[model samples]
Target chain A: MAVAHAANDYRLGAQAVADGVYVFSGRNEHFTRDNGGNIVNTGFIVGTDAVIVIDTGPSLQYGEQQRKAIAAITRVPVRQVYVTHQHPDHYLGDAAYADASIAALPATISAIQTQGNALADNLYRLVGGWMAGTQSQSPTSTATPGVVEIGGRKLRLIGTAGHTAGDLMVYDEASRTLFAGDLVFHDRAPTTPNADLLQWLNALDQIRQIDFKVLVPGHGAVVRDASAIEQTRDYLQWLSTSLHTAAEQGRDMVEVMNQPLPERFQKLAVHDEEYRRSVSHLYPAIELTTLPRR
Target chain B: MSRARAALLVCALWCAGSLPAHAATAVDTPVDPLNSPSWQYMRQRFLGKDPMVFDARVQVQMPSAAEDQMQVPVHVSAPGLTDVVDVLVFADLNPLPKILRYQPTSAAPDIGFRFKVEQSTPVRAAMRTRDGVWHVGGAWLRASGGGCTAPSVGTGQGFWQDRLGEISARLWPQQPGLERLRLRMIHPMDTGLAAGIPVFHIDRIDMRASDGRLLASLQTYEPVSENPVISVDLQHSGPVRIDAHDIQGNRFAATVTP
Candidate 1:
């Protein structure tokens, strides 16, 4: 799960994710795991008519790389760049694809406006020199999704928060490929701050309801079946359940982590160090005895 | 006699001119090493020197207030004192007090890295010599805080059972015998970021030569990014064997011949 290596490898390769959908994975070599998603920015070339770019990537340099990837396919005027979320990695590079109406959920736009500057500053410091071509400012003040389109080409934009307050999953009907933005993890666990464990399970259920042939994770390799999604869902559910049980029992956080989790989960990318924190966040939410009833 | 008296007068005059208006007389204060705040655990746990005298001039670069403490970038530099052998970073407030320890083969005194800061607390970087004389510096950083309990960065659980072995050393020899060894592993490095998951941490990584001699050994923590990329200076004089083990002794070993 060396995300840094992934970012540096796929700068401008027009690798196909689905039939028409092409993912332009950005350079992977970086200090930290630039959690924008392994796929630098995703998009598709629709015949000779127009090309719709999915996400713009983290910075201006990333945008340039995504553009070059698009150029390899078709010179068609880039009509629209659909941003999956408000996270800077998905939307900050919007300026690079100028003239294309930057599209996103209204909620994402608001989240960007609210925390863009602060997020940029925080990320810039963490990334150091890797943020060379990124937007100088977070664009928090000015970033408003110019053309907010909901569903496109049978690909539904599902509001899946918890990972972040404003996360959306793009479901392509034709390809049955769900571009899960930090929602699914094939190799590692998803980082969740605004994590509503229950809401996340519900969201996973929604994702499951859809019949998808392939699941394109926000990071890692593409998942080809529902089983992958199930693994992720089960992991979150188990964590919630375990944390809930601990909180219900009035157990000490440290003591709970010291106790081994389910053997099924030991191999799952859960960090031992983070056990206490996970318990703290989920303990309150899981304290509700009516989870099973819900 | 006369010459010594003249020198003393000249020194006194120079001090008077250089002194600030509110300068207080320099007092010979008792040095109580117990009062100084350094990670005693790191000193006792790791094989390092003790009674380290901390210097105040060397300050670390960190935000006054960070919005996100998940991956806070920190830079520590020792401008002078080339004789120092290594500088180790330790945080008093973090769950893992020892953040990173750099044993530099080169002459570079400055080392910068991106790591997760748990909370608003003082971070100390102690530099020690071959003779075990430790010189220390520290700084207070106000991070957004949430490392001890932050969620895992991965999507699901752990590394794929298939990919677990892939976590090994990938060595590319720039020239003959001298190789640039990039050893990567699939580790979650769960810095107590999230809730529910149990404690699973890789405590020590011993990188040794084939002849049973040690090249470099790291006492790691959850703060190190997942699948920590450790680049070691390998001379390729002998075959290499790197054995990395978690706190639970789940050993992942790799071998390479540069």
Candidate 2:
């Protein structure tokens, strides 16, 4: 049961799906101040002696709100915060939990250190003043890919470089819910700014092989079945093949971007926007690869 | 009344001498509204109250939208024509819009140039013929500016120091009288977008004849790709010299003869 909290300070409706796992799902929209930078799924698992926060939201404001909401739900000590990836939406909020042991993949932490400030500047540019005091904070810990035990709870941390270089996924044995960071966007359109589509396909196959009843994605609504994973896989494959074929045929970027979207993915949120961005991001490199060496 | 009649007589004589013998007017609808304003302003600024109709006689080939705001490729070409005097290139929305004024020395017929752009605007080539009529041609390109204020991607960690001040310029006849002059220099047109990387770029170029008589000159800003190489049509190639400088006032010069 989600214990009621102060609506004004923490309005996130934490839904308890299993015995001790509660998730606060963000809206299927771009980061905006009105939404308070809550554009990703944040989950907290209540262990016997501590709480595990999975993927803090985008800003300190969102992280603080999530922390208060979790405190309202349980009195357990929030032991560790696992950042799913280097994307600002998933890790910038760790600033609010400065005292907590925040852990992320080694590559993810490095990215935050090198390109993190640039990403923070972009976040402010895209979304207005909602991130007034928000900034990227380096993770305090590196959670290697293995079984992490906290407060008698056994959680599996799997590392995959799919959507980004340091994409992370966490699975709970007790709840059977997989926190598939940016690897899966569920019903929403998956962003591929730093995607390796071929590896992303392999990552999806890995997710399919995992034993999980609930899939909490970083961007969209939580899924109860593996169909969402398959849908995302299909979308990635289709767009990649389409662009690859276009490149082989000597089609320019403008022509490739105007190619019709696959019928199956026509209804995806931000389909056009993401499709345009993906074409711009991948086509130039793909074209260079196809060109004759100097 | 006597003064007014004399002015009318002068105007008629001038119109008679100025009108083309056979005017094949090129008609094209204005670009989209958000974009049309810049090009319109450019034409008004250059053409004054009268805007010339476009003609394929002078064709401009440019990317519809630039992937890299800096280092945009532009090519202008026209078939062999004796009336061709010079070609002027400009980007309607660039901070310094007038990019090139190509005065063919040996009667150049082909030109290819590149520069930086700030936003979506028309990349135009206006060819002035012997009759003093401008035949316009253009292509629309969109850009996310900051080329002038962004750091050079390839110049990090003091790499630009090794190649700075190097100049490479050459010219050759495309066939006979038509020639191509390509003048390139080593410099990073840093746009100043990155933290701590200041705006560094070659901002001006003066093309002079063997006698140092100005053939063409233009003001450039960042968004012009790192290591700017400008190719233009040239007719008179008698020890032609070019002098250029960046925002920091670092001077570079080169002379080539064919």
Restricted to chain B, the TM-score per model reads 0.61, 0.67
Candidate 2 residues B151-248, lDDT tens each?
A: 66568657669878676655555555445555666787776655787777788777778888776665565556676656665556455687888888
Q: What is the TM-score of each candidate against the true structure?
A: 0.49, 0.67
* Clashing residue pair totals per candidate (backbone < 3 A): 42, 16
Task: Name the regions of candidate 2 deviating beyond 4 angstroms.
Answer: A1-10, B1-32, B35-41, B44-93, B98-145, B157-258
Winner by DockQ = 2
DockQ of all predictions against the true structure, Cα-based: 0.02, 0.07
Q: On residues A1-294, what C-alpha lDDT tens digit does candidate 2 reach at each position?
A: 123113223377788967799999888776665665566888999999999999887776678788888989999989899999988888888988887899999989999999889788768766655566788889998989989789888999999997988888989988898998889877777888788898899999999999899998887878899878988988899888888887555444555666789777888876876787687567655654443211
lDDT of 1 by residue, B206-234 (tens): 66767777655566676765545444444
Model 2 — TM-score against the truth? 0.67
lDDT of 2 at A71: 89
